[model samples]
Target: MDGRLRVVIAEDAAIMREGLTQTLTRRGLDVVAAVADAQALRLAVEEHRPDVAIIDVRMPPSHTDEGMRAAREIHRDLPGVAVLVFSQYIETRSATELFAEQAGGVGYLLKDRVADVGEFVEAVSRVARGGTVLDPEVVRHLLGAARRADALSTLTPREREVLALIAQGHSNAAIAELLTITPGVVEKHVAAIFAKLGLAPSTGVNRRVVAALRYLGS
Candidate 1:
């Protein structure tokens, strides 16, 4: 994953698609192909085998779940290719379904993120490098809707914030930087979150992913 990576975009809105293409190109990424529908997306990915694919949550014919289905297929068939599910609003079901049984090299971002070219590009790159990038709003919504809300009610506000950041795949250092707190304090919050949530100590499982699953009621 060196040099400018090849990208494939599948978005129905012409203006939005073109804008994305221009932005990625301007940022030194090569837009190998930009298509409008799920079929075209599959074809483009199969033909180009790009490093990353930016896909919408809906498109063309049915305009419902087509993009999501295509994204899942790409993730299955092209393990090396990173997929970013870009949408206007948070769809909890879609987000959970996309991450089901897998957590690496994936991202779910709101379209508003496109306004900040730096952040958007960094997200894409992070996904390309086998890292996860979840939208903060998505995390918030899931946290707010956690099953057995009482289970999460014990966490302090600051501890809850740390849990959400962990779910977003941010390291303690990154979380500290964003929250302007010392890394040691972040670790303390993380410990408090795990304890409050009653998550048993484990070595094989990712506690962050577990926290997210709890939020999503899984």
Candidate 2:
């Protein structure tokens, strides 16, 4: 706690960008960079390389998918950086596409989460360390969609527990410790969960688990 968490704020609105910068800096966190568009946002990340990046889902000329696009690039270029996306609308498609590679160092939450500074800061710190934090609202929608497809029923009792943990974005070791099981058993259960969900094997850092998340999300 002696040192501050380095951070960047990217939002299309000047006021919002300023507010975020001021808020975090007042919290003893460093506002290393702040940008108003995706392009600047990208450069700031590579140049300043903050511990966490808070970006608005809508930004720039298009103001549609720019934020999400920037987020993907940040993951590709700086896999260690945590990108927390704030969206006014819950875009399930954006959430699903992110799953194509599987969420890593990412948090997709509604913009409202930032209103509660304590909770918002906690999320930022969590994601910066490779943890995934999804908005509860997003989780509810994903779980609901999956239920309609009967995906939840595919899990065994144990598998279901594992799936819940996956949705919570816990690592295999953490899940094992939480459940008092061996890491190997957690791995096996995760693999089984992915297969049951009909998602192909993953290609990213947290692939299989992320694939399983697409189902748990339902």
Candidate 3:
């Protein structure tokens, strides 16, 4: 067994499945299995137990959310394996549901992101290592569709901006630099954001992920 990251591709489209298998293989990752439907994807993951499974949100028969359902099942039954779900169109509800249930070793991205091979591979690697990744567009939708409008309305404009960056998986220092403010200021804003949203104050990546999930009203 090679030490490279093992991956399983579960895309219904033949072209996409082959393209991803070849792309990941060329990038030095092991493509243990590539399947076209949700059932095959589940079998591949159970058999190979790859480090990560890349799945399409829609697949087979109804083409509704077979892949997403399979992903949820895998995440529940095999906590060690990561799942990265991508969709051709943005589905805010699906993204919210996924992150709400599985905080670590999960990601939701748009299919268009595959066009940038480098970023796509990085996202896959990040998820495989138990890190969370959310597409910027998905973050926007989550922020906009937040259910707690009254609570969200209480945030200052700056606080709201900081929350948006947080939901995009940015660190405090990164948010500070992007907003051209000191880290201290970013910290204050983060605390305030959590307070206004009725979340417990904490630190680190997991805390930020929880804050992001809370921001999505999950």
Candidate 4:
């Protein structure tokens, strides 16, 4: 694998599609294929085997969750290829569905919040390298949902804070830095949160993502 990250874009709008391609290309990412529909996006993924796929929520045929469903299929089938769902709407259900089973290499970001191109590119890179990324707004929505209130109530305030950071795709080190705590303490809190959430210890899975899924009640 070369140093340059490879990408595929699935957007129904031509202008947005081409603009993303140009923007990522200018930032040194390899835009292997940019298509406008789910089928085309799948074909591009199969052909290019890019490092990451940037997908929009609404696309062709139904203009609803076509892109969301496609993103799930790609992640389930091709675990190596990361997926970053870039959408204009903050669909909490869609976000939960995308990250339900997967651990790393998955992300959901609202299109309107992408004000900085550099940060957006960094998100793409992060997902490509097998990391999770979620919009803070999405995190807040999930955290505030009443359905998960009973389960979440078991967590201490600090543990809840740690869980929020985890859902936001922050590493223990990053969370520690943000909260002004030590990484060792962050690890302890993470372990405790997983336990309280009843997420059994397992291998070949991202506990952080599972914890987030539990947080989202997905």
Candidate 5:
């Protein structure tokens, strides 16, 4: 928390870019650059040499896995830079693509997390510090893949409560409010869920959404 981390943010949406930048800045992290497209993201990373890159999982010109590809390149060219990916949905291929590069120093979280600036910033810091952070939603999707065997078995009752909230796309604060628990307690539950599912925190949320649909579809 003492040493500020340099960060580059890339999102195709303008409002999201601005909001994220302002939020990160308010949290005392240095947003070295903010861009709207994949090309701009590449250039921004090259120019800024940020310690971390907080990127949306999709961007133009194709708006399909562009951010994941850019992240791959950054992981290759800028090994020191971590990436935290945000997404509205989770698809299996997307998750495979992002982590296919390098799992370390990466994060995948749902866009809903943005509502809780405190938790979002904490996730950013975790990735910057070369630790993984995955949205518990992603973990539920992964665990759900286990079929009727009760995908929920991997967690304690408390963690199951957290995962159920996550599957509903609830924010940590929202989950805390619903359960009459503290956000910190929710975080512990989330951590437990992630460990049981073998999901790194940085697994992109969109990918998890895809996984969830697939798991739940059956």
Candidate 6:
């Protein structure tokens, strides 16, 4: 988690895959393998055992959800390998599926976000270190869908912002800094969130990931 991360890229498009490899390489990450289709992605991950894998949501041979499926398998089989699902659409269903079983070391980001090289790179590193990373757009879509849920409706405006940041995989300190509030206040808000959502307190679980999963309706 401290040094350079090894990565595997899975995308159907050659241009985008190569470009991403070049970008990640330039950013100091070692691209162990870059492959097309979900099958190859799985094979590459198995062979390289990279720290993280960058996967496109759609891939070859009935491309509807091949990448998402592969991501789920990779996460299930190799718990240590982080997965970042890259896609052009929000695809709330796929997003929900990715976080269904686990939340840490996983991310869902839109392809358009790649334009912001720094943020994209940060997302990769975040997941590589067992942190969640949900794109703002993906978060918005999930939150929008959950608007009818009674618990979500009860959230105050400030609480809603804090929850959104938590869904973005931000730590208490990071959320506090981003929202320009004290860390103690962030902790209070998180406690309130858990209480309001009725999510039982558990020592082993990552609270941030739990909040994100709730937001995603997983």
lDDT of 3 by residue, 1-218 (tens): 86899999999899988989999899889999999999999999999999999999899978988998898899888999999997786666666777788799999888876568888899999999999988888888877656555677899999989999999989999999999999999999999987787777556546677668766653
C-alpha lDDT (0 to 100) for residue 185 of candidate 3: 96
Give me candidate 2's TM-score against the actual structure: 0.63
Ranking by lDDT: 4, 6, 3, 1, 2, 5
| lDDT agreement of model 1 with the native | 0.85
For each candidate, what TM-score against the reference? Answer: 0.65, 0.63, 0.66, 0.66, 0.62, 0.65
Residue 17 lDDT (model 1): 95
lDDT of 6 at 180: 99
Alpha-carbon deviation at 208 in model 3, angstroms: 37
- The Cα error of candidate 1 at residue 20, in Å, is 0.7
Query: What residue pairs are clashing in model 6?
Result: none
lDDT of 2 at 167: 71
- Error of model 1, residue 9, in angstroms: 0.3
Q: Answer with 1 or 4, whichever has the higher TM-score.
A: 4
Q: Locate the minimum summed-lDDT window of 10 residues in model 3.
A: 201-210
For model 5 the local lDDT of residue 128 reads 91
Regions more than 4 Å wrong, model 5: 142-218
The digit string of per-residue lDDT tens for model 4 on 1-218 reads 77799999999998999999999999999999999999999999999999999999889998988999899999999999999999887666666767887979999899888899999999999999999998998888765553455667889999999999999899999999999999999999999998777677788888889788777654
How many Å off is the CA of 128 in candidate 4?
0.2
**Residue runs of model 3 more than 4 Å from their true location after superposition:** 148-218
TM-score of model 3 vs. true structure: 0.66
CA lDDT, every prediction? 0.85, 0.79, 0.87, 0.89, 0.76, 0.88
Summarize candidate 1's per-residue lDDT along 12-127 as a digit string, tens digits: 99999999999999999999999999999999999989888999988989888889888988987798899999998676666776787478988989887556889899999999
Clashes of 6: 0
Predicted candidate 6 versus true structure: per-residue lDDT over 126-162, tens digit per residue: 9999999998889998765555367877888998899
> On a 0 to 100 scale, what is the lDDT of residue 194 in model 6?
82
Candidate 1 structure, TM-score to reference: 0.65
How many clashing pairs per prediction, in order? 0, 6, 0, 0, 12, 0
Q: In model 4, where do residues sit more than 4 Å from their true spots?
A: 145-218
Q: Which of candidates 4 and 6 is the stronger one according to lDDT?
A: 4
Per-residue lDDT tens digits for candidate 2, residues 1-218, read 34788998888888878888887788778998888899999999989888889888788798788888888778767877788887776766666566446576788888765568988878888888778888989888766665645866777999988877777888899999999999999999987877676666556556555555565545
In candidate 2, the residue pairs with backbone N, CA or C atoms under 3 Å apart (3 or more residues apart, or in different chains) clash, namely 142-217, 142-218, 143-217, 143-218, 144-218, 146-218
